[model samples]
Target: MTHDPIPARLAALKTTSTPDLKSQWRDLFDTEAPPFNRRYLESRLAYRIQELVYGGLKPETVRRLERLGEELDGGDKRKRGIRADRDRPITGTRLLREWQGVEQIVTVTRDGFEWQGRPYKSLSAIARAITGTRWNGWVFFGLKNHRGRA
Candidate 1:
């Protein structure tokens, strides 16, 4: 009888140590593991292992999924929009706002925001630093209106 190694590998994830899981993540993803919880790593690693063995979704399936997404959002990002993660801009986008006669530029990064050569976890933090007062970062950056319009 042929032995299936996939089952054993997956079952091992539950008992694997944090360091081991990270090592496995590096091996499977060819990069460092994200700073997420152990459950997130295990779930992603499980999916990646299965995907590597059985292959990922088909190209036609991918296209169909994309079409479905567009249908849900009216195919126009500016029209219906996909607010999957709040209203954060896409990574690599640069936001410009003039504050007190000086133009403030903030760049969107994969992890967070970058402003003035400093990395910030939230826009509110940057807004606080910029104004030295409590301000809604979204409104401060013009991402949202006073009435909460995106």
Candidate 2:
């Protein structure tokens, strides 16, 4: 049997007071390229309405959405405010220069060398062994005396 056209079925569905009809419409749009393109175009019209109704999102929320989009599109996954170059020891020196805390020191036992007042055998070993998500400030700063002299 031939199926009823989507526009007619959608019109019929609209007469009902079901909240889920929006989602059903979305699903139908996903299945049909023409409907999908139409809905995509129509959604742009609602952008201003959404902004007006929601009173616009906060700056932080907008940033989060941008970041999420980047991640979804296989772009950068790094968090904002985190400098990409700062992940390396050489670049992290700036952070070390700014902070005056002994806690910045991370001890390395393999190389038997002190880094930022903590001991470490080699940078590679430190990189390999310290598998945490946090930034390492010690390696970049180099060893400093208790007086804070590098």
Best candidate per lDDT, number?
1
Give residue 26's lDDT in candidate 1 (0 to 100).
Answer: 93
lDDT for each residue of candidate 1 in 57-149, tens digit (9 for 90 to 100): 999999999899789877886755534686789999998988899999999999999999999988889999989999888899989999978
Superposition TM-score, candidate 1 onto the true structure: 0.51
TM-score for each predicted model, relative to the true structure? 0.51, 0.22
Model 1 pairs in collision: none
lDDT of 1: 0.92
The residue-by-residue lDDT of candidate 2 on 14-87, one tens digit each, is 35433344454445345322333344434432443345445678999999998887876567556454454332
Q: Tell me the deviation in Å of residue 128 in model 2.
A: 49
Best model per TM-score? 1
Off by more than 4 A, model 1: 76-150
In angstroms, give how far residue 80 of model 1 lies from its true place.
11
State in Å the error of residue 149, model 2: 68
